[model samples]
Target: MIKPYTNKAWYLVLPVFALVAFSAIIPLMTVVNYSIQDIFDANTRYFVGTEWYREILNDTRLHDSLVRQFIFSGSVLLIEIPLGILVALMMPARGPGSVVCLLVLALPLLVPLNVVGTIWQIFGRADIGLFGWALNSLGINYNYAANPMDAWFTVLLMDVWHWTSLVALLCYSGLRAIPDAYYQAARIDRASNWAVFRFIQLPKLKNVLLIGVLLRFMDSFMIYTEPFVLTGGGPGNSTTFLSQTLTKMAVGQFDIGPAGAFSIIYFLIILLVSWLFYTAMTHNDGK
Candidate 1:
């Protein structure tokens, strides 16, 4: 006879659940409370119902930011996903060389987010920065501070430099986890490199790629610190993303109710898009 599963072990895990409730759920409920009320001060607040959400939904600022955010995130996924796969394919599959490559790739990820922004900010300056100086020296007329397209290019490049390694490392681990028997079988079939990659390696990497895409998409969508320090959402607001917009509303303007509403909307958009990415990527699993 099969015994019923006992939940007594869960008692040991209860503290972790309580901690989550205290840390995340409580703050989330507070934001929910704020979203429904207009606060004039610490002691004064007026219930506004769903008014803030409706207004935020209609806000042109939100519309523009949403469009820009999607474009940036989309560009990130398009560039990093393939680039990462290429880098992984090029990485040594074993030996001291693999260890060295991993160390180098992991270096960028070790730097703090704000530090990465500051580094790029200085690095992209046409005055003294080597990257900018070299571009101007080449007669390309690159000035990120004065040109919108330049600013976009700089921001995109900065993001790629900083985050592509994360994808590469993930893909590399996935590649390494693949058993040698698969490669042996491919060899027996006299498969070309392209055929092997397209069929054997690529198929095995699907889960890893899914995780990378989801993570990159989420991070890119919510990106703030890098562009904020690098551009301050300038070059005519060309780089202003949803997070920056919400920050200005909440902290700069002190619109508690509206900011709360905006925050909820932003969170939902990321959540929905992440779910969509997961679904679309994993759709072929059962087949």
Candidate 2:
């Protein structure tokens, strides 16, 4: 007779579940509590009942930062998604070159975010930096500290350099999952390169592309460390994103009431957008 079914392994996972609840859920509830209150002291918090949220809803600074964040996140997805696919497609499938290519592409991801920013900061400096020296020699007037355009360009370029490898690696994994039979069939039919990519590769890679787009969008929208390190949201708010704005409100200015409200709203927006993306991507899959 067959043994009765059991799920005793679930007991092994209970400790992990408890740790996550203690770490994430507890702090989240604390934020939710703070978001609805006005505190004059540690023990003198008065229930404000969404007043902070209303104020945040009316804040013009938040509006501006939201718009800028949208632009940055959108640009990141636009650049990283297509470029990632192209890079993955060009990567070798086997042999020593493939190992070398993987290592090279992974180097950027290995660099710490703060270190990446510091590297670009020194690299972009106009006086002692190689990039600056070369640009000055060429008479390009490339000062990220003085011009908003230059600051924006530098920040965007830095982000692309730092994060593009993640997208490439994700897409590469998706590409490698396809069987040789598909390529053999394409070769048998004398398929053009574009046709093969369009019909076979693109279709197979769609799921991973969706994952890359969603991940990049979420991370880029909340980006703080690199830009904060590089420009300090400098040149008069040119590179100030939502996370920077939020951090300033929360930590820099000690506006806990508004910051808590701001964080909750921010979390909700991300949740809503992620839901939309997930729904749209999976809508036709079941059919």
Candidate 3:
């Protein structure tokens, strides 16, 4: 006979839920309040009722930054996913070498975002940076500060360097979770290496790949610090993403109402895209 389930386990999680509500929901509600108001000061404010939202929706800066953000995010996913899988494939299945490889791959992810930007900023400098020096020495002209393409290249390269490891680690874990019986079965069938990977490994990795893609997409979409430090969204705003634009509105220009609306819309876009990703990936699962 099945016993009645106890909800005592929920009591253990109530504090964590309450903390999340206090931290996230409260601030989100405040932002929603701000988005509908025209705030001249703490004391002087008027209800604008979606005026800011309408303005932000029409703003040309929003359009450009949205385009740039998508381009950057798309580029990141395209480059990192395959590269990460390849790196994971090359890693030893069981050995000290695997430990060392995992550790090295994790090092980049361990570095703080601001520090990653700073590291790359100096590293990409034409005057004293090793990267810049080598390129110049090899008769190539590369100056991220002055060149738009180079700045784009630098930001993309930095993101790939910093985040590809996350995907690899996820893929690696998925790989390790695969039972050895599958490999033995493949061997008994005399399956080619490509067949083993395609029919066995890749199939098992689907869930992890989905998780990795979502994590990377969301994180990359919200990026601000790294590019800001590396290029300051400079060389004529070539690398200016939606986050920087929102920052400029909210902090730099102090357009709180518009910024709040922009942020809400930004949040919605991310939510929508993530939902789309989840739906597309899982659509075939039920079949």
Candidate 4:
């Protein structure tokens, strides 16, 4: 028997759709409007179609920041993904020990972003901070404030310390969801730990890894608050990422037209990269 489809239930979703349109669409349209025009004031403005975009595209600062953003995001993914998997594998699988492990692992994620940066900022001081003091005592020249490489290393280490727990937790949940029969089968087959993990665990972790990779990539790419608080995009602009650049243009310099154009470009880049990640992961899954 054929049944006619009714869309009456869709009417119930109208309010939610309207709210999203009001919140997101309105602001986005405003940015687009600003991007296309040079605004002198609320009453005084001139249409300058794509001028800001052209200028922004040619800006060398943008090029540098974009390159740095990619490097930072890539480094985070390479370190965090494997380190997270290792941590998850080492976590207690049962009893009160499991609860304790989860709590400890989750602690870093609970800290506020700015606070995490502040903690690290203080912790990395060579004067009184234990980390810097210890390194200096060992005759290591570790001043993140003055050195670009040190700043980069500190930022990377801080990011890993703060966010690796998220990946570990996600992986742990994925591991827990696997049926015990798979483990039993591996045992009966006399499988090596490496063989079992390589064939069984790794394949099962694909979806979760995809999720972790996408999330970590996006977050790392768009990262601003922590680095801004910690480094202020200083040490010779070495840590000045795209977000900081945008902020300097919009908030610091009040270049509304150019900032709007930059914002659009930034949003597009994120959208495109995220789409690529999703496509690649899903394509691999299908194979």
**Residue lDDT tens for model 4, 204-270:** 9888999999999999999998779878987989999999999999999999999999999999999
Tens-place lDDT per residue, model 3, 157-275, is: 99999999999999999999999999999999999999999999998999999999999999999989988998789888888999999999999999989999999999999999999
Cα lDDT listed for each candidate: 0.92, 0.90, 0.94, 0.94
Q: How many residue pairs clash in each candidate?
A: 0, 0, 0, 0
Q: What TM-score should be assigned to candidate 2?
A: 0.92
lDDT of 2 by residue, 120-190 (tens): 88899999889877888899999888887888888888889988999999999999999999999999999
| lDDT minimum window of 10 residues, candidate 2 | 278-287
Give TM-scores for every candidate, taking all chains together and pairing residue i with residue i: 0.94, 0.92, 0.92, 0.94
Model 3 residue runs over 4 Å out of place are 1-17
Q: lDDT score, residue 93, model 3?
A: 92
Could you say which candidate leads in TM-score? 4
Error of 2 at 271 (Å): 1.3
The candidate 1 region of ten consecutive residues with least summed lDDT is 227-236
Instruction: Tell me the spans in candidate 1 whose CA falls farther than 4 Å from its real position.
Output: 1-14
Deviation (Å) of 66 in candidate 2: 0.7
RMSD of each: 2.6, 3.0, 3.1, 2.3
